[model samples]
Target chain A: MDPASILLGGFASGMVLFIVSVGLSVTMGLMGFVNLAHGGFAMLGGYVIVLAMKHWGLSFVPALALAFFAIAAFSVVLERLLYSRLYRAQELDQVLFTIGLVFVMTAAVTLGVGPETQVIRLPDWLRGQTDLGFMTYRTYSLALIVAGTLLVIALWLGFERTRYGARIRAAVDNRRMAQSLGIDVGRLFTVAFALGSGLAAVGGGLGAEILGLDPNYPLRYLVYFLIVVAVGGLGKVTGVFFAAILIGVLDFVLKIYFPKGGTIFIYALTLILLLARPHGLFGKRGT
Target chain B: MDAPHTAAGQLARRHRFQWWELLPWIAAIAAFFAFPTYLAFGTQLLIVILFALSLDLVLGYAGIVTLGHAAFFGAGAYTVGMLASQLGWNEPLSGLLAAAAVAGLIGFVSGLVLLRTHGLTLLMLTLCTMALLEQAANMGAHWTGGFDGIPGLSFDKILGLFSFDVLYFRSQYLYVLAVLLLCFVAVRMLVYSSFGQSLTGVRENLLRMHAVGAPVRARLVAVYTISAALAGVAGGLFTQATGYVNLSVLGLERAAGVMIILILGGYGRLYGAFVGAVAYMVLEHMLAKAYPTAWQLGIGVTLILVALYARNGIIGIGEALLRRLRGGGQA
Candidate 1:
């Protein structure tokens, strides 16, 4: 493939990763909870879109929106009932619980829907290539790039400008201190968790074509999502964006050149980078 | 509810053989004669218990949580398989030794790099290392057999005296049980030693241990290497007993399965492995027999429930119940 096409493909892939991983970053940073089930929420969103489009005759865009809202709403219940109980639990417990959730999600999906890959049909506008002044790119790829960029800007504003974002940031920095300062840390956690799940939902709905929607989606792409979060330095949006892009681009380009060793290279890279900076690339020192 | 670390030192200093500790061995021997026909399954269960025991050393005692222990297990299995199939060095005893050495070397080397970090990063690195090994194994499929796995692997008799398949795999069952017993004894010794107490200190609080002049990093690496070597022995036993090797040995599922076993059995406690392997295997067998598709679901529910409520596993629950019963009787 041409360099431009590879870059576009990588860019699109990175956006999907960023969208999926950004929520995990938020939860990990804000709540200090290792929510490995983040991918489960994403998988659920993919199913929602699939079921809506297939059974309800809903259009792709509407289905995606429905998936976003539905998963966000659903995750709030999960947060209150399941995740909240484990907020103060050890990292090992959190890991086990969430991994269990992943298994449950996988089995539930398999039992509910057949254990086959679910594909979404794109609208006519997203079906073909779009010719830009500089070059022609897949319309879907361009759409993803646009969506990712817009999401990034929106997240930046939300985190940097809004009062709620400030409270969330406070909780991330120090939950006890934030609570002492009269911040409703619990409420912040709920809202942030919901938003993160919602973003994951959108990413799942959008990236299903590239990442593939199946019963095994969570486990299959778990390492990828984790790499994004860990390398991006926990909870920062910009860090996740850059890290996602770097990983996505490298993975995409390397797979094209050295298909067998591409994933191997990424895994090795993650190991080395984390070893070099245990806290992550953009993560603060002493954390 | 007593923490393992807090009790570790006192247990290590005053630990002596208890009459109750003989129960598991008695049961093992009893099963050998009781079933007589199920040696193959017994051998498999023994291998799994051994594997879970190795994990307990690292995760439960040393306090290093990981998701990549199958790297060592797979390494050992592959080592034995490769040595036997390619070089025709099929001596079962020698093969087990070689497997342990190779896996221990890997553990030592990886531990040096992996032990530098703690918590999630360490967990991720271990995972990456395992993934790296799996990919390498895949790429080196010429020898490792990639996905198809090594089949038709043959091993010589135990000590040149007993055939593996003869008498309904009696020799295999005896051989595996003997090895498991030996390893279990060694583990018991280690866990009750001063070094073991130091490991518990490291696990309970790294900074406190370091401040108290403990070589925390070295202790962790040593325990990790030992654990990996033990796991390798289990893998070697598995390959020898089964006469086959496969890629799933290194897969994430196997890694997770072993961890689940340890958790269910109540890690850090020596007998947890035996209890966990029996429970998990029995549950899995029943689930598979009744509804193959629901097996994964069963495992999922078991894990979630265990993590949420039974964090220390069956042994922990048993301990709690015993304590409550004794207290009520006293009242």
Candidate 2:
């Protein structure tokens, strides 16, 4: 492929990563919850999308919608039942709990889906390439770039100009103080978590074709999400977007040049970034 | 329950080794002599115990959360594996020491960078370091065997005294037990030392330790190096006992499992490592034998329950029993 095609491919993957990782970044910063199982929700989304498209004969957009809303509803229940209790536990406890949840979800998917890679039938529009005089690009990539840009813009507006977003910010700043001011921090957390999970579902459903859908997807892709969150500064939506693009391009460029060494390059960069800014490139200090 | 710094350290040092404390070792020895068939599992348990003990040092004692400690373990394993497989160095005891030294060097190098961060950053950095190292090992697949991994390692003898028999694991079990005891005692001293006291201080409060002129970074690096060396010894023992070493030693699963063992046994307490490793390995053995296909589910559920409700683990229960018995059932 030409250089431009490779770069666009990287950008498309970056969009997928942004979609999956932004939620983790926001929730981690807001609640300091260290939700390692965010990938679990993403995996569920991939599975949902596959089942919807293959078994139920739903098209792409409707399937994506179903995955998002279904996962969002599931997140509310998980937040109330399990994650809420862990908010008060030690960081070690929270880490282990989420890791455990990842494993549990992995096994559940393995059992449910028979431990094989699931392939989805995308619409012909997605499979077709958009022709240009100089080069051609996958229609899905164009869709992703457009969708990611739109989603980020929408989320930015929501977070910056809405009452719900203000409440989440205030609750994140100081839970007790927010509650004292009659913010209903618990309800706010539940809402924020559900929304984050919903976005992750959308990302997972859309990105499955690029990233692949499998039982072990959660664990395999965990470090990527975390790298984005860490690099972007937890809780900064804009920062996560930039970090996702940076990681995706960096990873793609390295892989194109040195296939076996790309993961190390990305991780080494993340490690160095964290050493320089442990709170993240744009995250608040003292977190 | 909250006091985990100097007071708890002193209490641990002063607590006498009672008969109940000796009971486990006695049973282990008896099992070694009587149940010859179980020696394979027993030796593996002892190796895990050593690994978990190393983790307990950094995690339990220093309050560092590590998801990449398998770096040292894999280093040690690869050290011994490469030595016996390629360099014609077959002295198991010396190989173990060399492994420890190599792992300590790794710890010193990485800890310099990793110790600067804490919490999730520290955890992720360590993990990133592990992935990088594993990749480095993979790059040398010509010698290291990369993803397929290096196997078929054989040792000559233990200090030129005993030869290793493939089928029977008697000598291997005894040697591993002796080393485990030696390392356990050495670590026991290190944890109760003034330096170890400073470590707990850093763990509980870095600023206070630094304010009190405790050399916080140096203390952390020191304990981390020591812990790496001990874990390396475990890896060395594993390589020798199994006559096999692979990249799986460096995988995230082993690192995560070791941490789970420490938590299951109770973090920080020395015997907790011992108890936790034995319990984990035994449970794994039984569960794997029974579940076969779903053992991951079993372990997953157990970890979730432990993190949710039983963070203190078996050692905590033992301590509660001891306290209740001494006070005649009331605090």
Candidate 3:
């Protein structure tokens, strides 16, 4: 019932959503590929972190880094072998292929680690409540907010200020023209795909406690990711950031009042918003 | 001499009954006698065929990409479930009609808002609509039976003559077969109709259809309603056959499963439902039995292979073989 806690909790949830979904936007908007398996990679990332900490006796921070690098490397291989082949395919084919991947991934995860929820124990510094002068908030939520803000800044600088980021932007704007201008658009795409998927992995590792990791993690949260990307305007980092926060807060607050019908409201809102805009909140007409 | 060359003649030729079309019907009937012990499975196959056919109408023919066609199917099911269990309206025939009506109404209402968007937005909207319906059903657990589902639903005899025989399942099989026949005939007629051709035009190019004054949205809405109604009937039939209804009817898994069936058989072709259902059921039956736990791996591999190599599905592969046999290269 407390507004501050609601805002803090919802904002933290939103940050996780943004981290996981921004890669989807990049793949969907820039590559023009309907990669539904993005969540599968995120799920793998969760498993990577869980396994690293549980079995290897690794610390939480190292496990998080390992999740990012491991999933990133794995995603690059998948991009080259599986995804690149279907770049020119129809939306239907892309959807089917990615969904197929999700199925395989889910089945594999379930087989490997029984069909149970994987819970991670947070370190002392990251657990419990912290006084924010105005009100007390969960230290985990505060950490998520700070970490998410840092990522946003890092992404902004990477995309806006760096030559590589500018090249990625140019490629997304127009592939053929970017290629004609001596940019290796294909290689650029692979790098972007890795980073995007890696970021999703990091998000999954961080949000495993909140999101609940299981065999069906990919399918369970696929909608939230899609909502973030679609409502934010595909490929727009800032747009996804705002959309994720809005959806997260709305979902969190609504659930407090109407536990059973909170998701119903979200779905209805998405229907109306998409019907009116067709594109998204920040999308231009054609793109 | 020029009859085949004229547009009207070509339409007539395409609509004309083919002798080979009778083979499937004969096979369906033959299964009743051949598989006397497997009547229950036979009935399920018929229901799946009907469900897939309904989806083919919307997704394959009308070209609407929906991830939640199960919404209509679930609507039809809960309609039957609620009416029979709660209101004591247990007549099989009337219950099905009510199911179709309720499902069609939902399709019409949702389609009005849903058909406005295209691509990913439209896809998301359809999914949202289904999710909303599922949530509503879950919230109204008292009426819907919640996740436990509406069970112990009893129906009166078909036409008040043949009672449901749980032991033999003969009457259930025949009744479902009859309904499937009627639905298939109606779908065949609709597909060959000028209205159906106009839907194809809309699918091919929405802007061109708009420019040509083809009332694109109305046609879409009409087909969507009809498809929903048919899916509802399938759901109603499922409830009647088993005398049970569950929330899984509206689950995302069912939605995805139906799409997988359509893709396996090759969508856009009228017979795809028949081929796809048979393939899917048989594979699911065998793989689930064999693996017990990891059968989905088989399905996943099949889907990926189909998407990568056989974009058009099994039917497409057959057509390609036929083309090669006739020495027609890539027609």
Candidate 4:
């Protein structure tokens, strides 16, 4: 309808994508492991929120928090048991293993909760529209913007400013040298993985309503996540954020204006950009 | 090609033909006349195996990572589906011909652009191509049948002689088997040919290939086209046998399903496609029957285990066992 509504809606869409894809982008960039099953973690987080609210009688915020933390904790186990062993394996191996994980997660969800979409109840205050100056807007979208911005600021600070962040950057830039400098690169990998997985959960929990929580969530949405990573540049936080927003706005605008021709434009943009700039727009050389 | 003579290490690089090579043909022939009741399922598996075989050419032999090969497959299926229903050209052989031509044309055109990229970017490009095609098909709902899918496909008799029988399904199975065998032989020759060797060179070391005067990009595009053509054949056969064409053939799940099958049977091995197809389909049939709702979990778990431990697939495992036995016998 209104251009302003469309723009803000695009912004909200972008933020959720950022929340979903940031973890995937960073981990892939850092470890050189292509985790095709990254969306499976997001699906897990979405289900956690739905499960908590529906069965445990918890509200949205607390249920979402619980989902974020629980999936984060669970991811640590996955990193240790499975992902750690394959850090040095071939990229193809990593892809296959993660795809297998995706399958396992999708099938598990299907069996556990049937094949229907999982829905969570929100507070009455957040259910409907809020009157802005020119037009009414969804209250939840505003909440998402605030939350996503806060998370982005925190991630930027943590990634760019802190000493830990420096060590991670150094390790990513040159792993062997970082190891020689006694950086404990393996331990660094584990921590980075956990952080990414945790962030993924938070994004999934918060954006569940818009993205739709279902057993097929991972398979359905994984391409979008990967698109964010590829178009933004792997392991670059700011790149992922910017690319996600751009992609989100572009996707929404295209879909609203022209429903039949959205994926072509989005996918073609990624392809053309990749060809023109191999390491991504914001990435370093030779990545 | 002359075999390279070297020390003990080089012996492991040699590829001696094994008796297992004949196993698929023998089984194909046996099932040709034997399985009248289960012929339909058997025919489906043949199409799947052929699809995997095409993927193996690009993925296994050429070392290309493709995620949207289903594009060519859907192209072939749609081509044949349209030819039979719309154009009224239902000759089985010509239908296969048209499928291969259309699918091959798409493959060659796309491969030219895609061969310039490598690794994950190439994978994404292939994926995008499929997404675009699928969208086009979805948007052209009036002709392609959109979500409801294109059904009511009926094929003419094989060479105007062998009519498709209802009870036995012998003609259909026989036709599929004959084509599959021909394709297998063609692929076998291609892989062992000089071009295949140079293609492997590009896969192993592109810089060296360039230095040594090999046209690496062209070779890749050629292999990719051949692979697409084979996959197209599978798609055409699929609709002819099933009497329907669904857009799901172009989906991510279908692409991943074939990739999983290729891995299970072992990539790059000639007979690996057959072995992998048989194993994957049989397991799927049995597992789905046992756990209707959760059979996907079984496939997923099997894939995980195979990827992690059995990296070289069943054929590689067999080679290792054979080597170990030989060593023990010598000792």
List the candidates' TM-scores in order.
0.96, 0.94, 0.95, 0.95
Candidate 4 residue pairs in clash (backbone atoms < 3 Å): none
Q: Give the per-residue lDDT digits (tens) of candidate 1, residues A1-287.
A: 78889999999999999999999998889888888889989999999999998899999999989999999999999899888888777776777788888988898999899799999888898989899988888899999999999999999999999998888878877889999999988888898889999989989989998999999999889888988988898778888999999998999999899877568899999999999899788877784
- Expressed as tens digits, the lDDT of each residue in B36-96 for candidate 1 is 8888888899999999999999998998989999999999999999998889999999899
The lDDT for every candidate, in the order shown, is 0.89, 0.86, 0.90, 0.85
DockQ of all predictions against the true structure, Cα-based: 0.64, 0.63, 0.73, 0.67
* Pairs that clash in candidate 2: none
Report the lDDT tens digits of candidate 2 across residue range B1-331.
4447897776765745566767767887999989999898889888999999999999999998989999999999989988887888989989999999999999999999888887668888999988887888887877777877777778987878888867879999999989988898798788778887788888888888878887788888999999999999999999999988887999888898898888888897878888788777887888889977666787778878888877687787788788889899565
If the candidates were sorted by their lDDT against the true structure, best first, what order would they fall in?
3, 1, 2, 4
Ranking according to TM-score, highest score first:
1, 3, 4, 2
- Real interface contacts reproduced by model 2, as a fraction: 0.54
Give me the candidate number with maximum lDDT: 3
DockQ of 4: 0.67
Off by over 4 Å in 1: B1-14, B166-168
Native interface contact recovery, all models? 0.58, 0.54, 0.67, 0.59
Model 4's alpha-carbon lDDT is 0.85
